[model samples]
Target: MKRIKLALIPYSAYALIFIVAPILLILLYSFQDSSGSFTLENYARFFDLSDPVYLKVLWRSIKLAVISTVICLILGYPMAYILSRLPARIRGTVSFLFILPMWMNFLLRTYSWMSLLERTGLINSLIGWFNGILPSALQLPTLDIMYTQWAVVLGNVYNFLPFMILPIYTVLIKIDKSLIEAAQDLGASRGRVFRKVIFPLSLSGVVSGISMTFMPAVTTFVISRLLGGGQNALIGDMIENQFKVVGDWGFGSAMSVILMVLILLTMNVIQRYESENSGGSVLM
Candidate 1:
């Protein structure tokens, strides 16, 4: 145990320098105004509601993030199951296919989708093609969702679905075969087995995937900026603008601090739920 503690010293130092120091700096800067004197005004601006723009942006961020996380869950859970059931020979290949996109730059991956979704883009062209092939009443109209909330959600789901898949896949593959066999021997249908056994076992992974997906989805400025145009600016965009464009570091830091607290609170809720469920699972 002492040797293990000694091995952790380097990582502890690294976190202290890189993580703790930066957070302390952000906290210090968040409480200060233009004159560098400490005041509550920086935080007050966010919650003041007299001008509710920031509050609305934060809410929009949450809404879009929730949508993205839900979509990923719907898609990823099935994908993870399919991947987990694949034969070992092909499973690795399929998993690699999922991971291959990550090798590209994140911005580049997001920007690629713009071409597919934009006006005069492939989707619109495909719709136009369908229109040509069908009667007027049956024609598909051109999609105009570019630079909109839908586009933002699409962008988020595309980028973060893998985060959802990987964790659930990790947990699903680790499930004991005997437990599943025993459930089957008891005459549980596929749905019942999943509901009572597999799902309960995989709750930890689902919670982890939700956390991973929602955090990046909420805090992402790049996808929103590239796909949402300037109209659908999220809280992240607001923070970036404050620091980079508006030169209001104090307010930006305040927003960052708020984002951190919100994420931590969300994580805490998820962990608490996991703990309660885990205890009940053991009891069962």
Candidate 2:
């Protein structure tokens, strides 16, 4: 008991100083009025459903996060399965190659896509070259993909793909080879084996990966600002605007609190669904 308490003391202190303290400060600020009196006005502003703008922005953020999470899952699962099937000696190197982009500066990666997608950019330039061999009408239309919701989604998927891949890969690598072989020997189809055996075993990883990818994708302001343009604002952008441009720190803090609560609710619902389906057994 003493040893566990001693170990917890450091973590508790760190949490107090960093997480708890900051959250408390936000809560305090969230309840304060412009005149510095305690008030619920900040939160009440969000409850005004008549204002469609807030709901629109919030819904857009949710949609973007959901789409990105879904794409990451679809893409990551197969990649993870392929990597897990590789020989042990080459797995680490391949995994490193997969994750190497995530270690690069996020801002740099976001900006790089701007160069690739901009008008007269790499993609358009290639299209222009290909158009030389065809009638102008048959040429691909020049796209203004930048400053759009698609750009934001693209950036998000790129940024969070590694988060999704790593968790799923970790779970896949630990799957019992004998179980797969037994399923095959029992005359189960490959698809049936994957659906009945592999996917169920990887549910925990899916939950973790979806949570990691979705939470950050929704709360992210930088990618939206850089790629989606300032006009194509998300809830994160609205919170940032309140804090920085509007000078409404109290309202900003309230928005932050709301965002945190939404994320928690989403994760909890996902976990509950996963648990029910998996019969409450954790893969690990």
Candidate 3:
């Protein structure tokens, strides 16, 4: 027991100095004004009904994050299912291929997408070339989603899709084959088996994937900056601007605190739902 307590000291101290200290500083700065006096004005500025720009930005962040999460879930769930059903001989190779891009730098990946989405980028250039072979009326319009909300959404989906796929695949691959066989023996159709047995059992992974995907999507400033071009700034952009450009530490910290709280509340709701639904399927 004494040795165990001693072993935890370094880890506990690390957490305190790094995680807990930064959070406490952010919390402290959140409630202070320029003169270092305590004030609610920073939070009030965020929640101001008359000038709801910050609120609008926050809503946009949540909206885009939710859209990204849904798209990831829709696309990832099927991909994960395929991976889970793959033959064991080549499954690792296939999964490695799927996850290969993640080994690259995230910023570099986003920058590559930027090149593709640019007005005169590869996508548009391809459209231009394809148009040369057709009559004017038959020519397709060049892709123009760069610096738009759609661009940001695309970036989110591309970057975070793997996060969604890996978790659900982990769960799906671990599902007991006997339960699935039992469901089939009981005369369940393929779709019915998935609906009744597979999905319910994989809810934990789905919830985890949602949390992982949504949190990063909502908090990301890089994608929005590169793809959104600052016109469609999300809450992340706003928070970043408050600190980096506006030099308003108090407001920035307040936004950070609010964003953290909102994420915690959202996660809590998801966890509560997970808890309620867990084991409800009973392998049926």
Candidate 4:
């Protein structure tokens, strides 16, 4: 017990310096004005019903994050299922393929996406080439969706799909084969088995995946900046601008606190829902 306590000291100190300290500073700065006096004006500006620009940004962030997370779940769930069902011999290879891109620098990955999504980028250039051979009526329209909300969504889905996939896949692969076999023996159809047994058991993974994907999607400034062309500013972008460009640490910290609170609330709701659902399903 003494050794364990001593061992934890290093990690506890690391957490204090890196995590607790930063949160404390942000909390402190959040209530202070530029003059270093305490005030509620920062939060008031965020919740101002009259202006509501910041509120709109917050809404947009949630909206985009929801869309991205839903898309990931829709796409990832099936991919994870398939990966889990794959033959054990080749599963590692295929999973590696999914994980390969993540090994690259995140900035490089986003930049690569930017290149691909650009007006005259590789995708459009290929389309133009294909159009050159086709009749005028058969030519494809030039792609022009760059620097839009859709672009941001695309970036989010591309980057975060793996996060959704890996967690669900981990859970799916760990599901007991006997349960599936018993369901099969009990005359449950494939779809019914998946719906009744597989999905219920995998709820924890889905919850984790949703939390992981949604948090980053909501708070991402780089994807919005690179793909949104600064037109569709998210709460993240606003917070970044407040601190970096506007030199308003107080407002930035306030926004950060609000965003943090909103995230914590969302995660708590999800966790509570997961507990209730998982318990009920297991009981049934």
Compare candidates 1 and 2 on TM-score and give the better one: 1
Question: What's the distance in Å from true for residue 250, model 1?
Answer: 1.0
Give the C-alpha miss distance for residue 95 in model 2, angstroms: 0.5
What local distance difference test score does each model get? 0.95, 0.90, 0.94, 0.94
TM-score of 3: 0.95
* Candidate numbers sorted by lDDT from highest down: 1, 4, 3, 2
lDDT string, candidate 4, 73-135, tens digits: 999999999999999999889999999999998878887887887898989999999999999
**Steric collisions counted per model:** 0, 0, 0, 0
Q: Please give, for residues 1-284, the per-residue lDDT of candidate 1 as tens digits.
A: 78888998899999999999999999999999899998999899999878998999999999999999999999999999999999989988999999999999999989989889989998899999889989988977789999999999999999999999999999999999899999999999999999999999999999999999999999999999999999999999999999889999999999999999999999999999989998999998
TM-score of every prediction relative to native: 0.94, 0.92, 0.95, 0.94
Looking at model 1, which ten-residue stretch has the lowest summed lDDT? 136-145
Model 4 spans with C-alpha error above 4 angstroms: 1-4, 135-137
lDDT of 3 by residue, 49-90 (tens): 999999999999999999999999999999999999999888
Task: Predict model 1's lDDT versus the native.
Answer: 0.95
Candidate 1 local lDDT, residue 223? 94
Once superposed on the true structure, which residue ranges of model 2 sit more than 4 Å away at CA? 1-11, 134-138, 280-284
